[model samples]
Target: MTILSNNSQVTYSGTGRRKKSIARVKLTPGSGKLIINGLPGETYLQFSPNYLRISYSPLHILGLSNEYDIYIKTEGGGLTGQANAIRLGIARALCTINPENRTALKSEGFLTRDGRVKERKKYGLRKARKAPQYSKR
Candidate 1:
């Protein structure tokens, strides 16, 4: 995470990854507004409440949902992965804002980086671990 100050306004930034998705998030003091990839977050997320909820979970936990504007640039994987990545990024940025926030975020598991990813498909396998059918002659 990094912190940038411009004209007395502080901006906190963080990077997060989930599965194949990556999200770069910035937090600045402003009314609640979420922007993703230059588009309104709701539009980019297809207006899915679940996705919105996941992305905003950390802020809600800290009771600062409307205290900062979230700007995100995300790519890869799918909506689920991207949302999760955003969540982590937001959590990290919030921590930078205040060290005390870390304990709360960590207890809720927001600080945890999800390491699960798709397994590689083996050469002779139909899928990651699926095998072709065998039959007796």
Candidate 2:
């Protein structure tokens, strides 16, 4: 986590990863607004309520959704992965803002980094584990 001060306003930042996605998030005191990669969060996420909801769940959980602005730069994954990464990043930044927020975030499982990822495909198999069709005929 890092802190940046611009015009005397403090910004809290955090990085989060999920699968192949990485999200760098900044939290600043402002009306609730979400911006991702220079675009409105909803527009960038294709207006999918699910994605928006997932990305903002941490703040909503703490009843702080309207207290901060979320700015994020995310890349390298599908929407689901990116949304999750953003959620984790937001949770982490909130923790930095207030150490006391950690317990609440953790209890809600927002602080946990999901470790599941795509399994590597084997040399002679389809996908990660599907085998070729039998040749008994």
* Predictions: Cα RMSD each: 1.2, 1.0
Query: Scored by CA lDDT, what does every candidate get?
Result: 0.94, 0.94
lDDT of 2 by residue, 15-115 (tens): 89999999999999999999999999999999999999999999988999899999999999899999999999999999999999999999999999999
Question: Distance from true position, residue 36, model 1, in Å?
Answer: 0.2
88 in model 2: Cα distance from truth in Å?
0.2
* lDDT tens per residue, model 1, 107-134: 9999999999999999999999999999
Tell me how far the alpha carbon of residue 118 in candidate 2 is from the true structure, in angstroms, after superposition.
0.7
Residue 37 C-alpha lDDT in model 2: 99
Global lDDT for candidate 2?
0.94
Clashing pairs in 1: none
Candidate 1 wrong stretches, greater than 4 Å: 5-8
